[model samples]
Target chain A: MQIPAPFEYVRASSVDNALALLDRHGPESRVVAGGHSLLPMMKLRLARPDWLIDINDLFELDYLLVDTVPNNGRVLRIGAMTRHTTLLESDDIKRLFPIVIDAERVIADPIVRNRGTIGGSLCQADPAEDLSTVCHVLEGVAVVRGPAGERMLSMAEFHRGPYETAVAQNELLIEVRVPIRDDSGSAYEKVERRIGDWAVAAAGASVTLAADGTISHVAVGLTAVGLDRNVTEVEAVLVGQAPTEQLFVEAGRLTSLACDPLADQRGPVDYKRHLADELTRRVLRAACRRAAASISDITI
Target chain B: MQISMTINGTFVTHEVEPRVLLVHFIRDDLRLTGTHWGCDTTNCGTCVVLMDGQPVKSCTVLAAMVDGHTITTVEGLANGATLDPVQQGFMEEHGLQCGFCTPGMMLTARALLDHNPHPEPLQIREAISGQICRCTGYATIVRSIQWAAEHPAGAAPETTTSESTEQEVHA
Candidate 1:
């Protein structure tokens, strides 16, 4: 019985047209890509915009490509309107960043995945959101375009807070760029109430091993655990250290201490902290295993 | 606002308010009530329909968003008196304790079969995981979909005695 309040609808033919519509409608406008999250919120009266600018026609904003940036090596560029199904099925995403696959598989069930977009997920920015943590661990940057032009914002800057993002009222997130590193592997682990529910507490890890079999670059991010951004202390413990069960145990302990989770229906604060610790260790172990395998793949 | 789309192979147009959800538009405006609306929220897949050959929650989609797309509801599953394999499978396997979740489940199964003609039991469960069947007939539902996969071209529709008796009672 829930329905959105009366609002004017306009479909954008292109990205430029989307921006122009946003400007024309002013602050009372919102761009709906997937409408999975926004429409539900609108129904609940959580988000009641005066105008809805539908950008579903902007097919140009739906892409997943690997671009070789000058002096920056190769990076995966995911368009804003790319559906979750595409990410789950993309061989490029599976091979380059398995973390995305890991997260996408559990983001929603197959039906919802057909319509939900990566850009919509990012813009929704729920605290329990999985992809944000995945992007943070992968060090992804967002390409946001406004009337002034485009700006690249790091994951840390792009995600302002729970249900908040850096995408301005008149701007659109055009693409997400994740640098592909050599000898690196990434993974995400989450525990939800059901098959496609929000995470109770999830963790993502990206690890790059040096020639000496030591961690060279590492990033760990946790979801729904009151952690606003990536855990630097966990990274500090694992960096330059050899990948070992004992080392992972230490990292897990550090992760437990670093996160601050609140008690709710999912679990108590203690249970969430426990999940944060265990999931972090699990991801680190899997990531390091894949990282070593990637090195072997290169040499072989 | 005016919108036009293909629903169940039929071209239709309507002047609906911008806020009208596709589920309501299909049922209330077009009088295609076979697509049940449930939970209002997107959690329940009772409002699922095929959009561009993929199953999407119609309750979450605006009618305006589907202005020029194709949608297939349960009404489209059968042609003339011939039933789709999915529909026959349901009848053969007794897939419904209550028929509320049947349409969405069948649409999802159809889409899954289209992409993967032969999905395993676990795959079938995964495909319909988003939907809720309060009847707790998941075991029978999965069996029904499996039966549909076994009969890809569909089989002759047969009327069971109990169903015929129930129909006569209603009549």
Candidate 2:
């Protein structure tokens, strides 16, 4: 298939040069990192741009650093341009957070993982994206850079709505800072028709408990199946209650009740709601299992 | 746009459209017709090539993106008279039937084997999933890779995947 339309290809050697090209070209330009998602869209005539400033030469952007915090806090300093493969295969990720890394492995096929950059995916802002929900519970911070220098937005504020974000057109997401939970258990589970398709519904469940398994704090966020992401109802039922199978069931029911599923070909509204509930319960149990285990013994 | 690269161990350059795909650059522009195109979409590896020794789906990349990179096609597998071990293995094992997908299959298999010589059956399957052969199930294809890895006649590059790999560097 031929690449759609005609556009000027500006190969950038540095980030400053890239910024200058975007400044000079104005809205006529779009940045290309890996070109996994954007080029396909262009070929199908979904997103057409007059100019493409290739940032392939900007090798400095790809970095994944783990940062240590005082007593109870831990952080993952992730470069936005790092490929999904790098994250999946990273020893640091396995050490800091295995649950989060396992969730990333089921993203797409290997080639897509090797080429699709983290920043590019987040910038696309698909509602059903898996990483966004992980960010929701992990309470991550997104570092963005642009013509206006650099700024950081919390995960909560960064994702505004479906296919929407607080990021400006001129800005590029530089890095994502993700928090690590020591006592808390975290798990992400997603459902799709087949591999390579976007998620129909994704849920990230995090729960911290007392020494006796009594729930301390809880966060459950669902994406794709819902318009606006709201987890207050589920968290309310989960925080005070002990993380047993029964409580997880209630949380899943509450979360599913909050979703307004649109009737579509994929599944009926009720069917999707049922799936939302089941997936929520399953993922919550998995997360709770991880959380109840000792921090040093966190596996899977 | 003008793009130049080594094709079949010879320096070749040609003017192409900015949107021209690398597979087309290899087949139509440079006339190294050994590289075949099956599925234009990247899901099929029939248009795969050794671009800088990586088995990339040439159909998915723009010729302009790899102007100065070293490239290799099926025609470059042999040295004058002797066929590379992989080529000999394919013929001996009946690794091809219609033969349309063999070139891309061999190139992809070669790229993988060059990186990890003793690949397990599962790994070989993953590498070749991009290439679809209507006939001659991947059993023989995997055997061909295994055979080549076991017996290398110094025809192929010794070890590649970066600065060290290009014994036939032409740009």
Candidate 3:
């Protein structure tokens, strides 16, 4: 039977209480959101923290809010404790960012979805993790709260490496902020070995088209291919160009070269590189199609 | 640490080590052996139990985390003498072969039917996707859940357990 090593457990009553507990417990303490990732690691003796501060009772952090900034369009703010099931069932999330729905649908099975939280998924930061790639493509900003104050980190800044994040020993990731664009649409495409397995190779794209059918803004992010950041080279090639098969082909070529994947159980480097190129193109095409549909909705 | 929670409509409290998983707590401590423990890595759904009416892998959840919550194990599915629709459905449809995966499957089916009374075949498959049933190939299991949906109130309780109850009366 697998079991975690004995540790001290404390249930934090509120966000402030959680932060205080984290601050008090110091580096040896870890705040568990959903415990899906942490508990598994604990059982394996991979993550043996001295103290586990349970943040499951912090109901204040469980929310999804759409705030309209005076100048910066609408921003979707997801509380860190929001569960995967809640995200999957949210119509607002479905209507605003279908890419999240696409990613969540394939994140895990419905049962695991009940207990896993977005905050925990992001913090786990396994290189092949789908949500980190999705957040990267969406240009999400991680709102982190520490003893000093609150600070926001970009996806690139938040994710330092596999199984590492910017959330400090005494800090908590409070929210993820994604700016909502007017004529924008995003999509995530992934190929996994099984139903709930991590992606073999996946790509997510967010595209915004100008009134004249030219791409105004675009970001492409990849997963499981050893890329910490999105493919800016692909964005440079597609931005200001009309959505075309030729442009997507060029973007795909750039993506295949951009990612650095190692041979593992999922696939060899060549196969994954091929997936990087192909999934990139598929997501780009799908995002562009959805963007065009959004434009049509606005016009209608 | 000390933890208290409602299990199967009964309020229970116990002192457990922080490392004790909810599955072990239920089975080893509470002796609710119906909730099977399999695949400690959370891949298998045999350890599934309803946490506040949602199916969660009990193997991954810490006992302390559920200190103030309500848990429903397979033993809780039937109300007194009457079998739950899902239990009756399993009996009628022959959903189990080795019965290793039945308890979790039934609890999940019960939760699904509570949320969505009439789930499509595809929905049922998706709902139970995390669970692995090597014995019946999931065909009979799916049919079993459909039977539960069809008979939400459950047909008159008729099972070996009921017969044993009658035997006790005769004795």
On DockQ, the candidate that comes out on top is 3
Model 2 residue B127 CA deviation (Å) reads: 3.6
Please give fnat for model 2: 0.11
Best by lDDT: 1
Model 3 misplaced regions, further than 4 Å? A70-72, A297-300, B157-171
Q: Model 1, residue B38: displacement in angstroms?
A: 0.6
DockQ of each two-chain model: 0.76, 0.30, 0.79
Models ranked on DockQ: 3, 1, 2
Tell me candidate 3's TM-score on chain B: 0.90
Expressed as tens digits, the lDDT of each residue in A234-299 for candidate 1 is: 877888888989999998999999999999999999999999899999999999988889886432
Off by over 4 Å in 2: A68-73, A207-210, A227-230, A263-265, A292-300, B4-13, B76-95, B99-101, B129-171
lDDT of each: 0.91, 0.74, 0.90
For A98-122, candidate 2 gives per-residue lDDT tens digits of 6567568667555556567778777
DockQ category of candidate 2: acceptable
Residue range B31-110, candidate 1, lDDT tens digits: 99999999988998999999999999999999999999999999998876767778988998988988999999999988
